[model samples]
Target: MRSAAMRDEPRVTDAEARRIAFAAFVGTALEWYDYFLYGTAASIVFNRLYFVSGDPVVATLAAFASFAVGFVARPIGAVIFGHVGDRRGRRASLIITVTMIGVVTALIGLLPDFAAIGVAAPILLTLLRVFQGIAVGGEWGGAVTLAVEHAPPERRGRYAALPQVGSPIGTLLSSGAFALVSLLPADAFDSWGWRLPFLAAIPLLFVALYLRRRIEESPLFTELLQQQERSSSPVVEVLRRSFGRVLVGLSASLLGVGGFYLLTTFAISYGTETLHLPRSLMLGATLVAAVVEIAILLAFGRLAERWGPGNVCVVGGVASALVAFPVFWLIDTKNPALVVLAITAGVACLSVPYAVAGSLLTELFPPQLRYSGVSIAFNLGGVVSGFVPFAATAVLAASGKQSWSVALLLVGLSVLTALGGAIGERLRIEDDVSAA
Candidate 1:
């Protein structure tokens, strides 16, 4: 065993904490931007280009199926990259994930559509989507672990929330880009404008890699390395010893992941295809919601400081459940202002649970199994929730385009989030009582 003296590295300075947090924020934002841009394209562009069919709805379904394929690859990434993160270092794993995501996203820009490559176009696109999923599957746990581990103990909530900010930041950029490209004459936008956003990943890749390289490994991970206490099989260890924790973590994430995709991805399609709303209106509404969510997330981070993450998230989760039907009601009105309000309300409800999820998950697992444990739970939830768009789309189609069916699904997920969070809290209390 390493000497206690050797393990006692100085705590990270505030300046260094900010630097680490900023790098995490930037890298995660770019990854989400790349990942979410695909969802945006799926709703508006890919269905028309990659999957040509006589029926537009059938073509759109095919595209969503392809979109969901990415989720299937996430667990694979969690195992591969989680091992590296658990044994090697957080910085190394992050560098690899960011690079993989960036390259794949840029490559997507070069892919030929159906006209050029026939059936191969979508097949290739699905392959790239798998890579994207793997890259991101490995990303969230590493980012959260890095931020939380480097932070002062009392400030972990706020620090961990920094990475969560990346989601909305990414959404804002993705929606803004799509909205801009959407301005082109429909033919021009369809032909080439959609490619611009995907191609933009090239420069972002360099920036994220450059910033990530400048940061040190997590101090906690470095300590584990010095002690030579790394688990031989971190993922297996997590499953064998702490699977309940894993389930709780996954449960906590359902609403944020599921509800988020529904609002941003499926809502875009619903607005355009079913409601007969303009494409720009849907994109613009999404952009506004993204902007509002950023502030709400930051506020909740501060709220977590006083109220605790569990309490704040529980309240947020329940409130989200209550408002689910009303949110869809607003969207059904078809007024631009009401539509924006609907999306904004749905996303805002998500901010509370999302803000605390990083710190909460980090706390649930010990440092040795932290990377593997969080990665499995987070990515597993991602895989399950990844189908939200596809599932919501199918439900809408089956209901003959009734918005109520989708709303009910959203409410059900919110209830699950509340129950999952409560279970986690109960488990934590039981653990504390046992220790006492």
Candidate 2:
């Protein structure tokens, strides 16, 4: 069944590539579903049920801060999981991270509301969120490395992008779940409806674990083992040899990571509270946007193969900055269709940079240190991006609820990513020359 051109492809068989892609894509999707479900719950359920503040806005802010608390723990997770991933094997790290995320997420479902457990409710929720943060912080580097390292050199761009596709899939599943549950009568929804989505993580966890187990370890990592070239301390090694590139990678990722939460998480609060949009309408718009995002990400992933990932990402970064103001303008109109248009525009701009990020960043470090380098850079970026919802909310309050303030934040972030992408392009060239 192989094409004439594919017959000469190097390093990996088509069948093995397909298997690696499926395992990475599906496993990351399940983990992200668990992570994003918390964001959805933060906007709707957690503020009311866990925080229990006298003022609605105050409760919302507190809930968002709790969400940020998860990011605060990510670097720690990255170090712990990154070391394990680099030293032991990608398969073992994945097993631990996925299990941690699934268990924490399901426990969140079982947690009592403020009325039942009082202060203990919010405290326990924050702790569980921290565990979720650690698990996911460690999850991405291993997942992407497995896919990228298993791929043929020529197809690395496309294969690496396969894992990036997981974000939209996760968003779609989480938002779709919320949208369906948003249908219950207000009191019923407030009581137990939200828990259903969290509890649903159990089955997804099993499937993802099963898929991950069936896959082989990264061929590149296997080669490292055969050569007896594994780093004694990958975290330390990456920092020693590639710290600057790691910082550049984190900067490049800011727009995709932070701006996404700004649009989705902060936008949800803005839509419901300030614009008076129905929760269903907002969730529905996001659901549609998630679908739009998947298409855009897939298209961009393919485009990266032709255009070059850095060139494509540069285009995306600049475009995101340009579109920021108009997208917010559409949202301000409060029409459901316009809101969908606004979010779709945001996703369109963001997807290009995101689709190629795994491949682009993967090239920055040598294989022995790749897992650690990527993990540290990415989780640190998460630490920064993780605060977007909290910071955007404060900025909105300070600016008298003007959406432009948030739009401006997006513009600033997009510009940083563009500059970082340009720098990364230069670094990538240097890496290529050195490897050559």
Please list the C-alpha lDDT of all candidates, in the order they appear: 0.87, 0.86
Which residue segments of model 1 deviate by more than 4 Å?
Answer: 1-10, 429-436
Tell me which residue pairs clash in candidate 1.
Answer: none
RMSD of each: 2.4, 3.8
Tens digits of lDDT, candidate 1, 53-130: 999899889988888888878888888889999989889999999999999999998898999999999999999999
The TM-score, computed over Cα atoms with residue i paired to residue i, of candidate 2 is: 0.96
Backbone clashes per model, in order? Answer: 0, 0
Tens-place lDDT per residue, model 2, 1-436, is 1122122323778679878988899999999999999998999899999999889889999999999999888888888888998888888999999999999999999999999989999999999999999999899988888888788777778788888889988988999999888898888888999999999999999998898889898877777777676789989877887789889889888887888888888888889988999888888777777788777777777787777777777888999999999999999998889998998889778877888888878777777777888888888888999999999889999999998999999998888888878888787776556555
State in Å the error of residue 35, model 1. Answer: 0.3
